[model samples]
Target: MNTFIKSARVLSDGQLPKSGTIYPVLFMISISHLLNDMMQSLIPAVYPLLKEKFGFTFAQIGIITLVFQMTSSILQPFIGRLADRRPKPYSLAIGMCFTLVGLLTLSVASGFVPILVAVGLIGWGSSVFHPESSRVAQCASGGRKGLAQSIFQVGGNAGSAVGPLLAALIIIPFGQSAIGWFALVAVLAVLILVKIGNWYKRQLILATGKSAVSSEAVHGLTRRKIHTALFILAVLVFSKYFYLACMSNYFTFFLIDKFGISVQSSQYCLFAFLAASAVGTVVGGPLGDRFGRKYVIWGSILGAAPFTLMLPYTNLVCTILLAIIIGLIISSAFSAILVYATDLMPGKVGMIAGVFFGLMFGLGGIGSAFFGWLADRTSIEFIFQISTLLPLLGIITGLLPNIESKREVLNK
Candidate 1:
């Protein structure tokens, strides 16, 4: 049913396909990712200002986040599913348009309802951006899927890290109207996506040749086994993102409460953790390409557990260092886990990306809300003590059957 489709051929992990890694295309995709996520990250950064200007409550603030993120989460798989069935070369560019409008809307929004609508627009844009762009990354990967993914992802992580700093510097000082300035960033993203879209269209034409083969299945897994593995992966994702939510949403609070640090100092400490995460993301994928992904997955998540367990008991210096350690180690697992899943389910790349990315967004949202409720019931320090236990779930990493070993068995 593939229209003028290239033969969709699948290979075992790390095997080179016919195409070569297109770094220019990869860099373009990565830059688009940076611009896209940077715009989205502005919402939370501006929340304090929004509260002061609008006289909004914490409850309303939560509602804003919920609306923005849920749109970002819930619509992904559907868009990905549709794109899988019907590949849209220009969808990336079209998606950026949504972000552009959202930025404009948010900049001028005078009422709470308008702000919600604006954020929802931005979220919907993100839901479209991630899956399609991920597929594009793989197409240009030259079989280096893990490396492509990490490059694409690290851009986002870097953008997320930078957005807050930019907001604090630019938007905070200039006030709400300054949100409009970010529309320029969105416009830059649109231009890059257009070029990527053209490249994707060319790939389509080139791929229509006989060298394109249909997707091959992962060698040894049964339907049941595949499902089981996916479920296990989801559980691990939950553990990683939920624990991350604790750090991302409330780590600053924990530092202030536990060490009586200034808010600015805590933010600096948080940035250190975030920067380490970006580095970990870049490192994990190339390592997965070299080592078996299962080992990387097992090590990345489980290796961080000891540090996480020690975190709550540490003083100021040790706490920051522990957080950085935990961030670097745990962050590596996601790229490995994501690449592993795609290797198992080769034909369903877009769907898998959608589901995993959606889960990350959804679980992080749930974790933030859950911890907020928990912190209310107990103390923030107590919640940190409890959140530290989530990484213990990484012990389940040992349960994942090695896909490479299974492939070897099938070949023999």
Candidate 2:
């Protein structure tokens, strides 16, 4: 009787309803994403403070990022594969608890080893959070996968934008102990996620014995073609994130070094770039839904190349403007890329999201560490000049098959 009632109810009065775009769930999940990423963003946002306090070198800072990101990256695929086979409804909240503890530990961490341990815990939390959350986003997409992903992604972008600003205001002045306050954010996230978990549990019960929605591959592509396209997408991820790693981890240093700006002022500038990224993320998905993912991917990645190439030569004002433009244009590619990959190999949403998100963190980590090491050897400005060339690799987007149109035609 309970099973029949759930089937008839079909998702709590049209909120997570049976056959439409469940905006409520999407928005709620997006909020969780926002909180999750906002907390994560605090790590880099506090780097300057950490460096000054600990008298740490750039190389040490890079290793911190490497440790955090590697821990975040390594477990994602395995966790995602597990979730694909067996969904863990409450695991989201469970993961956030790790972040909560990490925050507390970081607040009191006195030495290098303690800081590393704290960050490692936070990374573990992120590793568990992303894959399942991504699977849930897709499950609730109601066929508007691109729009759904954009909605989900924009939250993280917004969080990333907000975090540094908050850090500049709070942690920079009050010192490390202030990090403890963010644990409250994690607590709130835990509460919200408990509610989401309840909904997810009902969804599992509702879905038992039911066939999942269609996730057929693009109709005309061979397995080899699919693999080739995925490889291209991976390379695009590398380009986009490697550049972003530079910005997120080191752009403030670039500004501080070149412009002689105050630390707080540089953080505000970083906020501008990340805020622009959030706005661009909002546009990327729906545009892909309306147009095709391939074009969006191609244009987004390549379009930023000119601006990036010009960035190293510009005045401070021009540099900030160029950074905004670069952020807006380049950031849009991620949603389109992820959606495109999922479209290529349907039904394995968990594993694919895990791989891509993992790759994103893993590559971003490696890039951060390399740039840190290089900056130690050379200079921040020189690295920026060299990294700008990465986006030129977007030309490879041409090699990606036009799968969306083909799929549409086949469906019709």
Candidate 3:
């Protein structure tokens, strides 16, 4: 018992008398990120099922997604700033509570309106969770920011992978209603665990008579660099997230409508895409660290364009293979983008995370709406083709001035 308590304390506080503690914190942060991601992925995973059950059209479904994304994105910057000012664990705990409520509501709701309301709640919950949790991860890393961010991002991808498979399993036997109940129960369990961890962290601070360090205090990047980087990041994030949202919200529809695949088969492809993305997340960070972050970022942007363009033309076997390959190529840039954002605002990890994850994704929802509109007018193939050019724009933006020069201006 004593050993367990000691280990817990060490893990919670980001203290390692030796080198072994990093992995555990990395693992926990990853799991927490995954839980948050699972919530996001689960919604899309079951979109087809919902469409069947509720008789929603593609346009209406797009609106529903838009509402969720916009709400979440708009609120992120505020949540992120708050995370910077406050104790991160407390913020994260609050986020978890929102997630729990949203999931629980989703489980019991019976109509489209009710489901929309629940999804809105879930978006708010996600907005809360990401910024704060990211701050905690940065703190916990004790300075290996790149690796920490990568592992943390990978957790969300991992959850995305698992959510569909789990949904498929639950939906098959128990029905969609059962899946919601299962999600609620699972979220509750996670909430309890996070709360306990927060309580333990507070006790340790009391015991030691020292508070955890603020994100801003640990590292410093100049204001100018932050502004410049954010501008560039905003462009990239907007484009990247726009593409991701369209894929998540509509890919199943595309598979069904275009390829004539069963709903189950479409989901399987989505799972493959997410699973491959998980690998990209894992690979992207270290590659960034070893090579220059810029190269990985630009390379991914350029490399993924062809694949994105190719997605519309492929057969089932080819589409599955291409989706996985596209996942790897596109996702490889994700962690690097986060790292670059953080590097731009070195001390403001929470704020950067919020803006990038929350705002970008939210705005992407809006972009997704535009894409959906395009789809309505034309076709999914055109949407995919148009989106392929977006990353090239990102590659251009990434070529902006270095962090050092930007910092010099801020120092003035």
lDDT of 2 by residue, 284-384 (tens): 99999999999999999999999999998999999999999998999899999988988887766777888999999999999999999999999999999
Cα miss at 308, model 3 (Å)?
A: 1.4
Q: Compute the lDDT of residue 158 as modeled in candidate 2.
A: 91
Lowest-sum lDDT 10-residue window in model 2: 7-16
- What lDDT tens digits, residue by residue, belong to model 3 across residues 183-291? 5544653664475457435533442433333334122545775576667667776767777777777777778887898877777778888899898888787877776
The lDDT-based order of candidates, best leading, equals 2, 1, 3
Clashing pairs in 2: none
lDDT of each: 0.80, 0.88, 0.70
- Residue 269 in model 1: shift from native, Å? 2.6
**Global lDDT of model 3:** 0.70
Better candidate number, 2 or 3, judged by lDDT: 2
Residue 144 shift from truth in candidate 3, angstroms = 1.0
Candidate 3 lands at a TM-score of: 0.85
